[model samples]
Target: MPNSPLHDWDLAPREAIALQKRLAGQVEREDRLDPVGRIAGVDIGFEQDGAITRAAVVVLAWPPGAEGEFEPTTLEIVEQVVHREPTRMPYVPGLLSFREVPAALAAFERLEVRPELVMVDGQGIAHPRRIGVASHLGLWLDLPTIGVAKSRLCGRHREPGPARGDWTPLVDGPDDEVIGAVLRSRVKVKPIFVSPGHRLTLPTALDWVIRCLGRTKLPEPTRLADRLASRRGR
Candidate 1:
Protein backbone atom coordinates (compact mmCIF):
# COMPACT_ATOMS: atom_id res chain seq x y z
CA MET A 1 0.00 0.00 0.00
CA PRO A 2 3.03 2.26 -0.11
CA ASN A 3 1.36 4.51 -2.63
CA SER A 4 2.77 8.02 -2.48
CA PRO A 5 5.69 10.17 -1.42
CA LEU A 6 5.51 12.12 1.86
CA HIS A 7 6.65 15.67 2.12
CA ASP A 8 10.20 16.57 3.03
CA TRP A 9 10.93 16.47 6.74
CA ASP A 10 13.64 19.07 6.78
CA LEU A 11 12.08 22.50 6.85
CA ALA A 12 11.85 25.75 8.77
CA PRO A 13 9.09 26.20 11.35
CA ARG A 14 7.09 28.45 9.05
CA GLU A 15 7.44 26.01 6.17
CA ALA A 16 6.33 23.08 8.33
CA ILE A 17 3.25 24.97 9.49
CA ALA A 18 2.41 25.71 5.89
CA LEU A 19 2.80 22.08 4.98
CA GLN A 20 0.54 20.99 7.82
CA LYS A 21 -2.14 23.38 6.69
CA ARG A 22 -1.94 22.11 3.13
CA LEU A 23 -2.00 18.47 4.17
CA ALA A 24 -4.83 18.93 6.66
CA GLY A 25 -7.18 19.58 3.77
CA GLN A 26 -6.67 16.03 2.53
CA VAL A 27 -7.61 14.21 5.74
CA GLU A 28 -10.83 12.25 5.31
CA ARG A 29 -13.21 12.23 8.26
CA GLU A 30 -15.29 9.38 6.90
CA ASP A 31 -15.24 5.58 7.24
CA ARG A 32 -13.42 4.34 4.13
CA LEU A 33 -12.19 0.89 5.17
CA ASP A 34 -13.49 -2.53 4.30
CA PRO A 35 -13.39 -5.39 6.81
CA VAL A 36 -10.17 -4.96 8.72
CA GLY A 37 -8.45 -8.22 9.68
CA ARG A 38 -5.20 -6.73 10.78
CA ILE A 39 -4.06 -3.54 12.51
CA ALA A 40 -0.70 -2.01 13.29
CA GLY A 41 0.51 0.18 16.13
CA VAL A 42 3.32 2.61 15.47
CA ASP A 43 5.67 4.37 17.93
CA ILE A 44 9.12 5.88 18.02
CA GLY A 45 11.88 5.97 20.66
CA PHE A 46 14.97 8.08 20.64
CA GLU A 47 18.49 7.04 21.67
CA GLN A 48 21.97 8.50 21.77
CA ASP A 49 20.65 11.73 23.16
CA GLY A 50 18.13 12.07 20.34
CA ALA A 51 20.77 11.33 17.76
CA ILE A 52 19.21 8.00 16.84
CA THR A 53 15.53 7.42 16.32
CA ARG A 54 14.14 3.94 16.68
CA ALA A 55 10.72 3.33 15.20
CA ALA A 56 8.62 0.20 15.64
CA VAL A 57 5.45 -1.14 14.08
CA VAL A 58 3.66 -4.14 15.52
CA VAL A 59 0.79 -5.77 13.64
CA LEU A 60 -1.93 -7.80 15.29
CA ALA A 61 -4.37 -10.21 13.71
CA TRP A 62 -8.12 -10.07 14.30
CA PRO A 63 -9.74 -13.39 13.51
CA PRO A 64 -13.01 -13.20 11.62
CA GLY A 65 -15.12 -15.16 14.10
CA ALA A 66 -15.58 -12.06 16.20
CA GLU A 67 -15.49 -8.46 15.15
CA GLY A 68 -16.68 -5.53 17.26
CA GLU A 69 -16.50 -7.61 20.41
CA PHE A 70 -14.50 -5.73 23.06
CA GLU A 71 -13.99 -8.62 25.43
CA PRO A 72 -10.59 -8.92 27.05
CA THR A 73 -8.56 -11.11 24.70
CA THR A 74 -5.10 -11.68 23.43
CA LEU A 75 -4.48 -10.80 19.80
CA GLU A 76 -1.60 -12.45 18.02
CA ILE A 77 1.25 -10.31 16.81
CA VAL A 78 1.46 -11.22 13.18
CA GLU A 79 4.37 -9.00 12.27
CA GLN A 80 6.77 -6.51 13.79
CA VAL A 81 9.29 -4.18 12.19
CA VAL A 82 11.80 -1.79 13.72
CA HIS A 83 14.05 0.71 12.00
CA ARG A 84 16.84 2.81 13.46
CA GLU A 85 18.01 5.95 11.77
CA PRO A 86 19.74 9.25 12.46
CA THR A 87 17.39 11.90 13.77
CA ARG A 88 17.04 14.63 11.20
CA MET A 89 14.48 17.04 12.57
CA PRO A 90 14.59 18.82 15.90
CA TYR A 91 11.67 18.76 18.28
CA VAL A 92 9.07 21.43 17.68
CA PRO A 93 5.65 21.83 19.27
CA GLY A 94 2.77 20.94 16.92
CA LEU A 95 5.31 19.68 14.36
CA LEU A 96 6.34 16.47 16.13
CA SER A 97 5.43 14.49 13.02
CA PHE A 98 8.34 15.93 11.10
CA ARG A 99 10.64 14.95 13.94
CA GLU A 100 9.60 11.30 14.09
CA VAL A 101 7.71 10.16 10.98
CA PRO A 102 10.72 9.63 8.71
CA ALA A 103 12.03 6.92 10.95
CA ALA A 104 8.56 5.49 11.41
CA LEU A 105 8.07 5.37 7.63
CA ALA A 106 11.32 3.48 7.27
CA ALA A 107 10.07 0.89 9.71
CA PHE A 108 6.73 0.79 7.93
CA GLU A 109 8.53 0.03 4.67
CA ARG A 110 10.12 -3.00 6.29
CA LEU A 111 6.83 -4.46 7.51
CA GLU A 112 6.16 -7.82 5.89
CA VAL A 113 2.42 -7.54 6.41
CA ARG A 114 0.63 -4.37 5.55
CA PRO A 115 -1.98 -3.68 8.19
CA GLU A 116 -5.48 -2.62 7.15
CA LEU A 117 -5.42 0.05 9.82
CA VAL A 118 -2.77 1.78 11.90
CA MET A 119 -2.98 3.22 15.39
CA VAL A 120 -0.49 5.98 15.94
CA ASP A 121 0.73 7.23 19.33
CA GLY A 122 -0.04 10.89 18.77
CA GLN A 123 -2.71 13.37 17.83
CA GLY A 124 -4.81 13.47 14.64
CA ILE A 125 -7.36 16.11 13.64
CA ALA A 126 -7.24 17.10 17.31
CA HIS A 127 -4.38 19.44 16.66
CA PRO A 128 -4.61 23.20 16.31
CA ARG A 129 -4.03 22.91 12.58
CA ARG A 130 -5.71 19.47 12.46
CA ILE A 131 -2.66 17.64 11.04
CA GLY A 132 -0.99 15.57 13.71
CA VAL A 133 1.45 12.68 13.25
CA ALA A 134 -1.26 10.09 12.75
CA SER A 135 -2.99 12.17 10.08
CA HIS A 136 0.31 13.05 8.45
CA LEU A 137 1.53 9.47 8.16
CA GLY A 138 -1.87 8.10 7.22
CA LEU A 139 -2.10 10.46 4.26
CA TRP A 140 1.35 9.36 3.12
CA LEU A 141 0.51 5.67 3.46
CA ASP A 142 -3.01 6.15 2.16
CA LEU A 143 -4.40 3.81 4.75
CA PRO A 144 -7.01 4.00 7.48
CA THR A 145 -5.32 5.23 10.65
CA ILE A 146 -6.29 6.43 14.12
CA GLY A 147 -4.55 8.52 16.72
CA VAL A 148 -4.50 7.14 20.27
CA ALA A 149 -2.66 9.73 22.27
CA LYS A 150 -1.86 9.63 25.96
CA SER A 151 -2.05 13.42 26.27
CA ARG A 152 -3.79 16.23 24.54
CA LEU A 153 -2.22 18.41 21.90
CA CYS A 154 -5.40 20.35 21.35
CA GLY A 155 -9.12 20.47 22.13
CA ARG A 156 -10.95 20.15 25.44
CA HIS A 157 -13.32 17.51 26.73
CA ARG A 158 -15.11 16.34 29.86
CA GLU A 159 -13.49 13.53 31.79
CA PRO A 160 -14.99 10.23 30.83
CA GLY A 161 -16.34 7.82 33.40
CA PRO A 162 -13.77 5.83 35.38
CA ALA A 163 -14.58 2.64 33.55
CA ARG A 164 -13.53 0.80 30.46
CA GLY A 165 -15.28 1.86 27.20
CA ASP A 166 -16.30 5.19 28.67
CA TRP A 167 -15.83 8.13 26.35
CA THR A 168 -16.90 11.70 25.66
CA PRO A 169 -16.66 13.92 22.67
CA LEU A 170 -13.49 15.98 22.44
CA VAL A 171 -14.37 19.40 21.15
CA ASP A 172 -12.33 22.34 19.99
CA GLY A 173 -13.02 24.86 22.71
CA PRO A 174 -12.75 27.97 20.64
CA ASP A 175 -14.69 26.78 17.60
CA ASP A 176 -16.80 24.22 19.49
CA GLU A 177 -16.08 21.62 16.83
CA VAL A 178 -16.23 17.92 17.60
CA ILE A 179 -12.80 16.66 16.72
CA GLY A 180 -12.15 13.43 18.61
CA ALA A 181 -12.93 11.56 21.85
CA VAL A 182 -11.68 11.11 25.39
CA LEU A 183 -11.79 7.37 25.92
CA ARG A 184 -11.26 5.46 29.13
CA SER A 185 -9.43 2.31 28.10
CA ARG A 186 -9.26 0.82 31.59
CA VAL A 187 -11.09 1.41 34.81
CA LYS A 188 -9.46 3.99 37.09
CA VAL A 189 -6.74 4.75 34.56
CA LYS A 190 -6.24 7.99 32.73
CA PRO A 191 -8.20 8.09 29.52
CA ILE A 192 -6.58 8.29 26.13
CA PHE A 193 -7.58 10.70 23.43
CA VAL A 194 -8.87 9.04 20.28
CA SER A 195 -9.12 10.81 16.96
CA PRO A 196 -9.48 10.02 13.27
CA GLY A 197 -6.19 10.17 11.44
CA HIS A 198 -7.17 9.45 7.87
CA ARG A 199 -9.86 7.51 6.04
CA LEU A 200 -11.88 7.05 9.21
CA THR A 201 -14.73 8.75 10.97
CA LEU A 202 -14.23 9.73 14.59
CA PRO A 203 -16.73 7.13 15.74
CA THR A 204 -15.10 4.39 13.72
CA ALA A 205 -11.72 5.31 15.11
CA LEU A 206 -12.98 5.10 18.67
CA ASP A 207 -14.75 1.81 17.95
CA TRP A 208 -11.62 0.12 16.63
CA VAL A 209 -9.50 1.41 19.48
CA ILE A 210 -11.92 0.12 22.08
CA ARG A 211 -12.06 -3.25 20.34
CA CYS A 212 -8.28 -3.48 20.47
CA LEU A 213 -8.09 -2.79 24.19
CA GLY A 214 -7.68 -5.68 26.57
CA ARG A 215 -6.73 -5.34 30.25
CA THR A 216 -4.12 -2.71 29.54
CA LYS A 217 -4.84 0.98 29.48
CA LEU A 218 -3.51 1.23 25.95
CA PRO A 219 -4.64 -1.00 23.10
CA GLU A 220 -2.67 -4.22 22.67
CA PRO A 221 -1.07 -3.22 19.37
CA THR A 222 0.03 0.20 20.60
CA ARG A 223 1.08 -1.15 23.99
CA LEU A 224 3.25 -3.74 22.27
CA ALA A 225 4.63 -1.12 19.92
CA ASP A 226 5.45 1.15 22.83
CA ARG A 227 7.29 -1.66 24.56
CA LEU A 228 9.14 -2.54 21.38
CA ALA A 229 10.18 1.02 20.71
CA SER A 230 11.15 1.66 24.31
CA ARG A 231 13.25 -1.47 24.59
CA ARG A 232 14.96 -1.30 21.20
CA GLY A 233 16.78 1.94 21.79
CA ARG A 234 17.98 1.12 25.28
Candidate 2:
Protein backbone atom coordinates (compact mmCIF):
# COMPACT_ATOMS: atom_id res chain seq x y z
CA MET A 1 0.00 0.00 0.00
CA PRO A 2 1.16 3.56 -0.79
CA ASN A 3 1.56 6.24 1.83
CA SER A 4 -1.42 8.37 2.80
CA PRO A 5 -0.28 11.94 2.39
CA LEU A 6 2.99 11.89 4.26
CA HIS A 7 3.35 15.68 4.15
CA ASP A 8 2.55 18.74 2.14
CA TRP A 9 4.41 19.52 -1.07
CA ASP A 10 3.87 23.25 -1.01
CA LEU A 11 6.47 24.73 1.27
CA ALA A 12 9.59 26.85 1.32
CA PRO A 13 13.07 25.33 1.23
CA ARG A 14 13.39 25.76 4.97
CA GLU A 15 10.11 23.97 5.61
CA ALA A 16 11.11 21.20 3.24
CA ILE A 17 14.37 20.73 5.05
CA ALA A 18 12.57 20.32 8.34
CA LEU A 19 10.21 17.79 6.79
CA GLN A 20 13.13 15.77 5.49
CA LYS A 21 14.52 15.45 8.99
CA ARG A 22 11.21 14.26 10.42
CA LEU A 23 10.65 11.81 7.57
CA ALA A 24 14.17 10.51 7.87
CA GLY A 25 13.34 8.96 11.21
CA GLN A 26 10.52 6.91 9.68
CA VAL A 27 12.72 5.44 6.96
CA GLU A 28 13.21 1.73 7.50
CA ARG A 29 16.86 0.76 7.72
CA GLU A 30 16.27 -3.03 7.63
CA ASP A 31 15.03 -5.48 5.02
CA ARG A 32 11.23 -5.55 4.95
CA LEU A 33 10.45 -6.68 1.40
CA ASP A 34 8.52 -9.56 -0.04
CA PRO A 35 9.52 -11.94 -2.81
CA VAL A 36 10.26 -9.89 -5.92
CA GLY A 37 8.68 -10.75 -9.24
CA ARG A 38 8.75 -7.45 -11.09
CA ILE A 39 11.17 -4.55 -11.04
CA ALA A 40 10.74 -0.93 -12.09
CA GLY A 41 13.00 1.95 -12.96
CA VAL A 42 12.04 5.47 -11.92
CA ASP A 43 13.62 8.51 -13.54
CA ILE A 44 12.93 12.22 -13.82
CA GLY A 45 13.77 14.79 -16.50
CA PHE A 46 12.82 18.31 -17.46
CA GLU A 47 11.26 20.02 -20.49
CA GLN A 48 10.00 23.44 -21.58
CA ASP A 49 13.03 25.22 -20.18
CA GLY A 50 12.69 23.31 -16.90
CA ALA A 51 9.10 24.43 -16.48
CA ILE A 52 7.74 20.93 -17.03
CA THR A 53 8.84 18.00 -14.92
CA ARG A 54 8.77 14.66 -16.70
CA ALA A 55 8.82 11.40 -14.74
CA ALA A 56 9.04 7.86 -16.14
CA VAL A 57 8.45 4.46 -14.62
CA VAL A 58 9.36 1.36 -16.61
CA VAL A 59 8.45 -2.02 -15.16
CA LEU A 60 10.45 -5.08 -16.26
CA ALA A 61 10.14 -8.78 -15.55
CA TRP A 62 12.21 -9.95 -12.62
CA PRO A 63 15.10 -12.41 -12.91
CA PRO A 64 15.73 -10.56 -16.21
CA GLY A 65 16.84 -13.53 -18.31
CA ALA A 66 17.95 -17.14 -18.02
CA GLU A 67 21.29 -17.21 -16.21
CA GLY A 68 23.97 -15.70 -18.46
CA GLU A 69 21.61 -15.49 -21.44
CA PHE A 70 20.35 -12.16 -20.11
CA GLU A 71 19.70 -9.66 -22.86
CA PRO A 72 19.03 -6.18 -21.56
CA THR A 73 18.24 -4.89 -25.04
CA THR A 74 15.32 -7.30 -25.31
CA LEU A 75 14.07 -7.24 -21.72
CA GLU A 76 10.32 -7.19 -21.61
CA ILE A 77 8.76 -3.92 -20.54
CA VAL A 78 5.78 -5.15 -18.58
CA GLU A 79 4.49 -1.62 -18.30
CA GLN A 80 5.61 1.95 -18.81
CA VAL A 81 4.15 5.23 -17.61
CA VAL A 82 5.08 8.85 -18.03
CA HIS A 83 3.84 11.89 -16.18
CA ARG A 84 4.44 15.57 -16.73
CA GLU A 85 3.42 18.62 -14.79
CA PRO A 86 4.51 22.15 -14.03
CA THR A 87 7.55 22.11 -11.80
CA ARG A 88 6.32 22.23 -8.22
CA MET A 89 9.55 23.26 -6.55
CA PRO A 90 12.62 24.85 -8.03
CA TYR A 91 15.94 23.08 -8.02
CA VAL A 92 17.41 23.07 -4.51
CA PRO A 93 20.68 21.33 -3.81
CA GLY A 94 20.17 18.35 -1.41
CA LEU A 95 16.40 18.67 -1.86
CA LEU A 96 15.85 16.66 -5.02
CA SER A 97 12.67 14.93 -3.78
CA PHE A 98 10.89 18.21 -3.28
CA ARG A 99 11.71 19.25 -6.85
CA GLU A 100 11.20 16.00 -8.83
CA VAL A 101 9.03 13.57 -6.83
CA PRO A 102 5.54 15.03 -7.17
CA ALA A 103 5.31 13.88 -10.78
CA ALA A 104 7.03 10.57 -10.02
CA LEU A 105 4.26 9.55 -7.63
CA ALA A 106 1.76 10.43 -10.31
CA ALA A 107 3.56 8.26 -12.85
CA PHE A 108 3.61 5.31 -10.48
CA GLU A 109 -0.13 5.65 -9.89
CA ARG A 110 -0.61 5.25 -13.62
CA LEU A 111 1.31 1.99 -13.86
CA GLU A 112 -0.85 -1.05 -14.71
CA VAL A 113 1.75 -3.50 -13.47
CA ARG A 114 3.11 -2.47 -10.09
CA PRO A 115 6.75 -3.30 -9.44
CA GLU A 116 7.91 -5.18 -6.37
CA LEU A 117 11.31 -3.53 -6.39
CA VAL A 118 12.38 -0.23 -7.87
CA MET A 119 15.67 1.28 -9.04
CA VAL A 120 15.68 5.06 -9.01
CA ASP A 121 18.08 7.41 -10.78
CA GLY A 122 18.79 9.60 -7.77
CA GLN A 123 20.06 9.58 -4.20
CA GLY A 124 18.55 7.63 -1.32
CA ILE A 125 19.76 7.82 2.28
CA ALA A 126 23.08 9.26 1.10
CA HIS A 127 21.76 12.80 1.31
CA PRO A 128 22.39 15.42 3.97
CA ARG A 129 18.84 14.98 5.25
CA ARG A 130 18.97 11.19 4.91
CA ILE A 131 16.03 11.32 2.54
CA GLY A 132 16.74 11.53 -1.17
CA VAL A 133 14.43 11.14 -4.14
CA ALA A 134 14.44 7.35 -4.06
CA SER A 135 13.71 7.16 -0.35
CA HIS A 136 11.00 9.78 -0.65
CA LEU A 137 9.39 7.91 -3.53
CA GLY A 138 9.55 4.61 -1.69
CA LEU A 139 7.87 6.10 1.35
CA TRP A 140 5.06 7.41 -0.85
CA LEU A 141 4.72 4.32 -3.05
CA ASP A 142 5.38 1.81 -0.24
CA LEU A 143 7.65 -0.28 -2.43
CA PRO A 144 11.24 -1.36 -2.04
CA THR A 145 13.48 1.15 -3.81
CA ILE A 146 17.19 1.66 -4.31
CA GLY A 147 19.01 4.80 -5.29
CA VAL A 148 21.42 4.23 -8.17
CA ALA A 149 22.91 7.65 -8.67
CA LYS A 150 25.39 8.46 -11.42
CA SER A 151 27.25 10.81 -9.11
CA ARG A 152 27.85 11.27 -5.43
CA LEU A 153 25.51 13.54 -3.52
CA CYS A 154 27.00 13.29 -0.01
CA GLY A 155 29.41 11.21 2.07
CA ARG A 156 32.93 10.11 1.18
CA HIS A 157 34.44 6.85 0.02
CA ARG A 158 37.64 5.15 -1.11
CA GLU A 159 38.18 4.42 -4.78
CA PRO A 160 36.74 1.14 -5.95
CA GLY A 161 38.81 -1.19 -8.10
CA PRO A 162 38.57 -0.72 -11.89
CA ALA A 163 36.54 -3.85 -12.45
CA ARG A 164 32.92 -4.76 -12.67
CA GLY A 165 31.43 -5.44 -9.18
CA ASP A 166 34.34 -3.86 -7.30
CA TRP A 167 32.97 -1.63 -4.56
CA THR A 168 34.01 0.40 -1.51
CA PRO A 169 32.18 1.66 1.52
CA LEU A 170 30.77 5.16 1.35
CA VAL A 171 30.96 6.55 4.85
CA ASP A 172 29.73 9.62 6.65
CA GLY A 173 29.94 11.25 10.09
CA PRO A 174 32.96 11.41 12.37
CA ASP A 175 32.25 7.83 13.50
CA ASP A 176 32.43 6.66 9.89
CA GLU A 177 28.92 5.39 9.40
CA VAL A 178 28.27 3.49 6.17
CA ILE A 179 25.77 5.40 4.12
CA GLY A 180 26.13 3.66 0.78
CA ALA A 181 28.53 1.89 -1.58
CA VAL A 182 30.66 3.27 -4.36
CA LEU A 183 30.35 0.66 -7.05
CA ARG A 184 32.07 -0.03 -10.35
CA SER A 185 29.06 -1.09 -12.37
CA ARG A 186 31.17 -1.60 -15.51
CA VAL A 187 34.83 -1.63 -16.41
CA LYS A 188 36.46 1.64 -17.48
CA VAL A 189 33.54 3.61 -16.11
CA LYS A 190 33.08 6.00 -13.23
CA PRO A 191 31.66 4.50 -10.04
CA ILE A 192 27.97 4.74 -9.22
CA PHE A 193 26.60 5.23 -5.72
CA VAL A 194 24.10 2.67 -4.40
CA SER A 195 22.03 3.18 -1.27
CA PRO A 196 18.92 1.77 0.37
CA GLY A 197 15.83 3.81 -0.28
CA HIS A 198 13.21 2.00 1.78
CA ARG A 199 12.17 -1.46 2.97
CA LEU A 200 15.69 -2.73 2.27
CA THR A 201 19.17 -3.03 3.73
CA LEU A 202 22.47 -1.77 2.33
CA PRO A 203 23.67 -5.27 1.42
CA THR A 204 20.39 -6.21 -0.22
CA ALA A 205 20.38 -2.94 -2.12
CA LEU A 206 23.88 -3.61 -3.41
CA ASP A 207 23.06 -7.20 -4.35
CA TRP A 208 20.03 -6.25 -6.42
CA VAL A 209 21.98 -3.56 -8.22
CA ILE A 210 24.65 -6.05 -9.23
CA ARG A 211 22.00 -8.43 -10.53
CA CYS A 212 20.39 -5.76 -12.68
CA LEU A 213 23.58 -4.45 -14.31
CA GLY A 214 23.66 -4.42 -18.10
CA ARG A 215 26.64 -3.82 -20.39
CA THR A 216 26.61 -0.14 -19.51
CA LYS A 217 27.56 1.68 -16.34
CA LEU A 218 23.91 1.71 -15.27
CA PRO A 219 21.74 -1.18 -14.32
CA GLU A 220 19.13 -2.42 -16.82
CA PRO A 221 16.17 -0.93 -14.97
CA THR A 222 17.29 2.69 -14.59
CA ARG A 223 19.27 2.53 -17.84
CA LEU A 224 16.14 1.86 -19.87
CA ALA A 225 14.21 4.48 -17.96
CA ASP A 226 16.96 7.02 -18.64
CA ARG A 227 16.76 6.32 -22.36
CA LEU A 228 12.99 6.57 -22.35
CA ALA A 229 13.17 9.83 -20.41
CA SER A 230 15.74 11.33 -22.80
CA ARG A 231 13.58 10.57 -25.83
CA ARG A 232 10.49 12.01 -24.20
CA GLY A 233 12.31 15.13 -23.04
CA ARG A 234 13.18 16.07 -26.63
lDDT of each: 0.87, 0.86
lDDT of 1 by residue, 1-234 (tens): 144354467779999999899999999988899788898999998889999998999999876344445653658779898899888888887999999888888898888888899999999888999989999999989999899899988887899988789899999966799989999898888899999999999989988888888778898778889999998423
lDDT of 1 at 16: 93
Which pairs of residues collide in model 2?
none
TM-scores vs. true structure, each candidate? 0.92, 0.93
Top model number, lDDT: 1
Candidate 2 accuracy as lDDT: 0.86
* Residue-level lDDT tens digits of model 2 in 1-234: 145362478678888899899999988889999899899998988888898888888899876555352234555779888888888788888888988788888898888877899999998899887899999989988888999999998898999999889999999988888989999988898999999999899999999998887678898889878877766422
